[model samples]
Target: MEIEVAIAGGHGKIGLLLGKLLVEQGHTVLGLIRNPDQEDDLHAIGVEPVLCDLEADDDVGEAVAGVDAVVFAAGAGAGSGVERKRTMDLGGAVKLIEAAREKGIGRYVIVSSMGAADPPAEGGDAFGEYLRAKAAADRALVESGLDYTIVRPGMLTDEPPTGRVEIGSRVERAEVPRADVAAVLAAVLVAPNTIGETFELISGETPIGDAVAAL
Candidate 1:
């Protein structure tokens, strides 16, 4: 149970929260961050930070080396344009899959969006394009031949973690806290039954443990 897990966007809202929980559960967490300055933030929570750029670097394999599982939480952000959306959201995920394959790491998890399964039919705006990019990335992971779980959460909020969630193959739009999403991601990472599954999450009655165990 002392496996090592790495989070590609380790400093991100969900990634950082998940890293803390993983460390507390007696797992070693390696957080891949673009800024070396963020090392202190991760170290403060007992996470080992590995500095690497997911979009523009060639060291993804090295960044994720020796980890038992990987969680890709990287994104280009709302202010970013179309190219960045593809380069970071889609391209970043593909690189991680390639690295996981190259390094012999089988377990992979992705922090995706609810609409990723089906991109918007007619729009090229940022949100529309973002969904398209995510859909592409999700497809890549499924075809990567790796043990993967794609957790798509609806409207992200900054509220506190509910420790409960509603999980299904596809769910309606609703808001869930970033903290809850992090907790669910952490749970999904170690749940063997969750492998090869893609689910959507939102606020609900089922506890995190039960939600994932029932996967």
Candidate 2:
């Protein structure tokens, strides 16, 4: 089943990899980017570029107007402070949901962090604030009545893909490669059983495809 998918924060590591995986799997991938410079990057990976800012786009529906599914992969960078975290992480996902409903797109996936569900007490730190934003976004998406899956991966790394993973409600604290994460996202997009589930991901012995199948 081929589908047209829109990826928010299309230039990010995980997002770009996910888009490329989708493209390789014969799915049309539209990457939403705010910078013109990022256009070439997406093109090189076979992902069509759609110019839009999750934070600044007045009508996000226009960006995802024709997509069959939407993946929220946008986030404030490591250097970002607390404000951008809310605007980009929390607010951006919320707006994406609205756009999904307006565009009549039912399939949605969110790339979140492992601790987002039960973040540490607000310690007045940027990381703490990020968790809060993610939790809120996940909550809203689940209650939005959309077919959504929240993938909470443990500490992400730039390591090469191990082609193995562990996926369930909770996984041991471990690092998973960005490539493995992308592979999981691609599978979840096509696997109907993954809908309405929020799972944690980590590196394990099970193959990526098998892990997703067990979802």
Candidate 3:
């Protein structure tokens, strides 16, 4: 089943690969990017780019206008400060949820981090702050009355795609490749059983195909 899906921050590491995979799978992928210059890259990869700043946008409701599903994959990457972490991670997520609600779009997915359910103690580090923000956003989305899935992945690596994965209520202690993360997101997009369930995933030396099948 091909769906018109909008990927917020579709140019990031995991987000970019997910957009490519979705496009290859015959899904209409609209990438929401902050930089206009990023559109060319998306176009080259067959993703239609929609320019919007998640932090400052007041019209996200219109931006997502006709899409069937929404994937919130945007985040403040490493080395970012606390402000950016909150703005893009938590605040931006909440804003997008409101936009989805106003537009009447029900299917939503959030790319989150492991341990988000239990944030680290304050004054820890930037990554700690990020987890707390992601947790807040995940909780908010679950209560928003939208059909949503929150994917909490462990430390992300850049290894090539490994088809095998483990999916459960909590994946707190493992490292998963970004390619596998993208694959999981793509699978969830079409898997009816995964809807409304927050899942944690990690690669386990199995083929990506077999891993998805196991899910």
Find the candidate with the highest lDDT and give its number.
2
> Weakest 10 consecutive residues, lDDT, candidate 2?
115-124
TM-score of 1: 0.97
RMSD of each: 0.9, 0.9, 1.6
Model 1 residue 153 lDDT score: 93
| Candidate 1 Cα misplacement greater than 4 A, ranges | none
Could you tell me the TM-score of candidate 3? 0.94
The TM-score values for the models, in the order shown, are 0.97, 0.98, 0.94
C-alpha lDDT of all candidate models, in order = 0.92, 0.93, 0.87
lDDT of 2 by residue, 7-30 (tens): 998999999999999999999999
Write one digit per residue (lDDT tens) for candidate 3, span 19-102.
999999999999999899898999999999998889988668877888888999998888899998899999989988998999
lDDT of 2 at 51: 91
Query: What's model 3's lDDT at 189?
Result: 87
Q: What is the lDDT, from 0 to 100, of the residue 198 in candidate 2?
A: 98
